[model samples]
Target: MVGSSVEGLTFDENCQVLSVTAPAGASGLPVMVWFHGGAYVTGSGESTKYDASLLALEGVVVVSVSYRLGIFGYLRDNLGLLDQLVALRWVRDNIAAFGGDPSNVTAFGQSAGADSVYALMLVSDEPLFHRAILQSAPLGARGPERAEMTAALREFVSVDASTSVDDVLAVQKDALSMASARFSPSGGMPFGPVLGEIDLAPAASRIELLVGHTADDASPYVPDQPEAWEIATELVFAGPARQLAADWTTAGGQAATFDFRWRPANAPLGACHCMELPFLFDPAGWSHAGMLAGQEPDPVLAKTVRSLWTGFARNGMAALPSRSLELGE
Candidate 1:
């Protein structure tokens, strides 16, 4: 870990900025700011799953952050968005010290992290990022409402939902205080981002973007629940899913979409969520040999995807496709 700090930010004493850089001789590396996903309720920059050292070796400076997750960072008390914005500000001002080109930063995330990427684009009109990659999360999806969230909190705290708003606020304050007393700073459930009021600003158009979902995105989240899987499939692919597709297109955005329905013939399970992660990271040399399903990870596919990502960070166009991943052309 390279020791560093950014200025013009006030973190809740426990929070600190972390920076990771490529080895020496690696010059002019692109920077990727990665955000982890755990339904906005869990997850951190320290997950073993996201090792940026590999990407750093690929000539990219990777900065994985430890933002307040759940209630601590997402309490929505008017300061929530400000807190996230400050983190981006830190990246903007200080990433250059670690050999990162701040101007060419791409924000990447999966699931709730992807949700944050979408929210950041919509809320931050100043546009701190040059490109964004949202995996397994589409924009404009319905999440929890504030009132519903409050009621859930009330139930968790064993308080009556019918209590006055001010009383409910008191309960929340006390609950947060008690939570702090018992657990370390890391223990907190993040309430997801809000839309209209706190994030009332329109989406940023200048940044290049890559947004898509896995063929079985919700698989990992609810594995072994067959009925749940069917419901999610309908929801994500057929039902409101089309609206999300239309929303992406209507935004005048350049995006590449893929449906990875490649399931192993022997495995009882279908294409479930998070199946794309290993493929995207191309772990276990699967990209070279292909998966058991005979679904090869085409270099053309990898190049097509990574080129769009890197090219977007370099220049804000998804770029002309060099090859096709889907059969339709």
Candidate 2:
């Protein structure tokens, strides 16, 4: 898909693994690095769900990352976060080759990816990127206890510090789904960054942030339990995001909040989780709009969101949603 969208494509073999999409003749464009969401057990930077072609063409360099996941990412240590931090360092050092400004970069993610953004922001002592756009971050995830992971691991293999990566992957590939389901009550995700290990440097710092949630973001996750859905969405995604905005603002940082309430026509998923993606990536594109039929997203509305996202990376300020959402104080 990316083959036809840009003038070039490149992958790195260093501490990071990212795909760079460079627009034709684009140079010094602001960079937008994307992180994909998959419950933290599944997903890669290469998922079609996160295509950055249109966004890149609109005047920014796009970098989509593939970070560690599942047990490989968060089991006993924050190895997954280590990979993500390395990716950021790579962008800070190498995005210029793709016409991206090393100093002007924005990191964006949704769901588990959004959770990653939150963790990353909290851990960085200095600016790895100038801005962040978090979508539906599950801040309510409980820290996985090492004993629990060890017990889970023993259910698959006996360990003596002699276990190999192959043994670990073999067990995780088969057991993660079960483990995540078992630990669902602790954290919303199958695996997440552990507490005491996800501390951000200096405890407080201002970062230009654009955070939001779909009005009905939790429907897809808990369609049957309406009451549970509403409460979880607020406590885990919406409420925490609002508090983060308020905290950032209180710390003298700038933040713009949004409520994606655009309902899709003829779709059971109202303005559900990830529903805003079709609009942000490409409202008119067939991949995401196949079901929109007569309910195609407004071109003006799509443009407005695209502009706000890129604008945040470019200028440290995100414009309000077309329906007029306000930036929090």
Candidate 3:
């Protein structure tokens, strides 16, 4: 693993490591910092799902950051988001050693990670990165209801700080089950950056942006509930993504948007939540992902996506998806 794999429940010195990959002989290149998503509870920046080597080959430097998650991260505060802030500051001060341009950093992520980037935009007092690329962020994840947080807290109150990490995870799993059962169409995650709990700083209205969602981003999660899928796809992803771009532009910031409509041929899931990831990362890294269905992403589409992403990091603008689909028949 490029960074320390936090795969198992046990913690080690390498748990919160950050990994960097730079092009051969790279210097003064644009840098991209990636935050992986597992609903704020289940991912590691070191996961193979986020291998950035292929993206680095597109003539840029890529850094993947690992942050705290779940009860350890958001049980009482925005600790995960704070951890990311620390990583950004580290990049600002030290990325040059990796042949990257510290001033041209772009903070990018998918799903919950994308939400973290958005939260950072509001809370960061100083500009940590020059640009941001938010992929499928649940911008519509409404929150801070006293009742919901209180209910969530009750689950944690029984957990002792001295409990083993693995035991704590079991408790988290139980809590997640309860939370999932209580989830409604009105978008809000059980564990994520809560609005009222986080003090809102100045808006990062000036940062350039590249934002969008898969055409059918909510399909996979609501495979059995079509109505829920429709509502979640639009309310939780598509509608808010478009609104974020519009608001960015309205705030006098440069922004680019895309609608990824490509899914594997005959993929029942359609272009769901993470459909575009293989195109941005190395398909090999996502080989075991159920969403891909053992299919290889079109290499041409992958190249196009990589180009668009790196182009944005280098110059803050990349051509939007020209057609409804970037791949598939």
Best by lDDT: 3
Question: In model 3, which runs have C-alpha deviations exceeding 4 angstroms?
Answer: 1-14, 143-147, 154-156, 185-188, 197-202, 226-228, 318-329
Each candidate structure's TM-score, on Cα atoms with residue i matched to residue i, is 0.68, 0.80, 0.88
The TM-score of predicted model 1 comes to 0.68
After superposition on all CA atoms, how large is the RMSD of candidate 1? 9.0
lDDT by residue for model 3 (30-149), tens: 999999887787678777767788999999999998888877787767778778989999999998988999989999999898988888877766878988889989776653343475
Residue 180, model 2, lDDT? 55
Best by TM-score: 3
| RMSD in order of candidates | 9.0, 5.4, 3.7
Q: Flag regions of model 1 displaced more than 4 Å.
A: 1-16, 78-83, 138-147, 150-190, 197-204, 225-231, 234-242, 262-269, 280-308, 320-329
lDDT of 1 at 117: 78
Tens-place lDDT digits, model 2, residues 1-329: 11122113332223146788878988999999888787776666765556778788779998988877766667657788888889899989888877889888888998888888877887767678878888877765543444475466546544445777667667766675566566654434656665555433233355578888877677666777766767767766788778777777776677777777776566565566776776677543334343343466666777777877887788776344432353211
Best-to-worst order by TM-score is 3, 2, 1
List clashing residue pairs in candidate 3: none
